[model samples]
Target: MFDNVGYRPGRKPQNATQEAIFAFHVALRTGMRSGEVLQLGARTLDVGRRVAVVEHKTQRYTGKPRRVPLLSPAVRLLKPFAVQERIFTIDDADRDALFRKVRDRLMLKHLDFHDSRATALTHMSRKVPVQVLSRISGHKDIRILVNRYYRESAEDIAKRFA
Candidate 1:
């Protein structure tokens, strides 16, 4: 399901470059679900720690929040837009529309914005510790998370183990 993950959907409105890039950059760093990221409040970000404290979509029932580390690039991209209540001004409908327009324009097949989660996971799994990755990804089972998101070569995995 996580195949063909190269193209990241930019958050363009009417083909504008800057806004779209920022939106895409945020999704790329967080690995959060659309609902979770859309509702992510400003308080979630700890600038000093460069981390976003998120309550996983699945964790609404469990009530434990996870600490997701942010890339410096994403922090820079978000800093200008960060507000008192939310990081993104757009709602879910706007997010969906923006992502859909970008996907259609790029002519990508089956590449939904949600796939950005896999993109983030694949990027982080290579370097992040399993425990931390599980927390950030909000996946209680690392096997499912790794199997679904990461398609590493046997040699690459072997090197990781070594």
Candidate 2:
């Protein structure tokens, strides 16, 4: 979908300004929500262990913390952007502004930052099961996830029946 916007799969972003871009790619690759990505702090990531501690948004079913394994690409992108105490900080408004700029720069129309979360879920569904995906996504219910986040293609269904 973003091929026209110069989104090359497995391509690393070039600069600090593109850190968010790199982060976005990592989020999608790891099936993380945008809020989870935004809330990441220095203590959240353990580069040596290649793990990330994620605080799930207080939802009914999932009120505790969960851990996500970091991929090599995500680790590489995050190391340079990591600060002493804070990993990444941006206010809500600033986040929105940044999203707008990134969307425009990428020539994406009507795409919001939160959409990245959806994209991540959609893409990762093929590789992982709903149960594992729910853990990473912090979704309270698997049914909600199946209904909302997981994107199924008609071809996928046809192939299943065939």
Candidate 3:
């Protein structure tokens, strides 16, 4: 279900650098905020476990770190670049620029970097139960999740009524 064109054994974009595409794909797959994705050091990834230990940006709210599982596409994209000390070395400003530039060039309407995280949570909400998604998304409380994240979609309600 993941549209992993750039991340999975595909050619790099002509105008964009590999790093640019990589940052965006990682954001998409990991559900990491652009800032946290920028801060990721290579060591945070556990290849054996297929999880990334996020330096949770919302740690002050959640008071715990989060471990996000990586599917094969993400892991494949990571393996080659795994040697870099800082998984992503680009600064916040440049990171945003690259993501925006690619989004525009591809004509992906109304897309922004932060949408990647929201997209991830929305998709996962269907597959992962709220309790598990709370941990994955680092939501401080279930109410915060149901009240804010993925509020538009209620799969169970649809199924029940139908």
Candidate 4:
């Protein structure tokens, strides 16, 4: 499905399709929501520190800022546009439309951009503790992290134990 975007990793995004793909990559890598990923700017992202501290969904309830650790892949994706006020020029509507087009072409029933958060956190659960994953994901409740986001199949878990 992403093949239609014609985006090769490490290449600068040249068009809207490529930009949307890159934005998806950033969200996948950072575990950031689509809005947070789109809102990212040089002011919020610290490539040098490999972290992005921003006001996010749980900040209001938690009374703490969300600190998103930028993995190497995310750092590479953002480095090019780090100087810009907005990392991704793509807006919500454009992104939604672009993703909808891809979803339709690929015949995917549920391919929303917001799914990146669950996908990212699921992947992170394998390597990080639940507490750490919650921090990365800005989930105040560990139950939400384990029950909602960390979706590993029983077979997959059994294989790890085996």
The better candidate by lDDT, 1 or 4, is: 4
Candidate 4, run of 10 with poorest lDDT? 1-10
Residues 1-162 of candidate 4 have per-residue lDDT tens digits of 457877777666778877777787788888898778878888888899998877777667879777888878788878877777876788878987887787777787677787888898888888888898988888778997888778899998898889
Clashes of each: 2, 0, 0, 0
Write one digit per residue (lDDT tens) for candidate 2, span 4-105.
Answer: 334454444334334455456657666676666766667787877877787766734566567877767667766654544654455445556666777787
* Best model per TM-score: 4
| Pairs of colliding residues, candidate 1 | 11-20, 12-20
lDDT of 1 by residue, 60-131 (tens): 777877777777766765555454477566766776776676667667768877788888887887878777
Q: By TM-score, how accurate is candidate 3? A: 0.73
Q: Which residue pairs in candidate 4 collide? A: none
Assess each prediction's global lDDT (C-alpha) against the native: 0.66, 0.65, 0.68, 0.81
Candidate 4's displacement at residue 30, Å, is 1.2
- Residue by residue across 1-162, what tens digits does model 3's lDDT show? 113224433433333344566777777776777776766667777766787776666677767677777767677766665556776656778877876766777788598777777777777787778898887776757887776657444675598469
The best candidate by lDDT is: 4
Regions of candidate 3 where Cα sits further than 4 Å from its true position: 1-17, 60-64, 151-162
User: Looking at candidate 4, what is the lDDT of residue 115?
Assistant: 81
TM-score of 1: 0.73
Question: On a 0 to 100 scale, what is the lDDT of residue 23 in model 3?
Answer: 74
Clash pairs (backbone) in predicted model 3:
none
Query: Could you tell me every candidate's TM-score relative to the true structure?
Result: 0.73, 0.70, 0.73, 0.88
Error of 1 at 69 (Å): 2.2
Candidate 4 regions off by >4 Å? 62-64
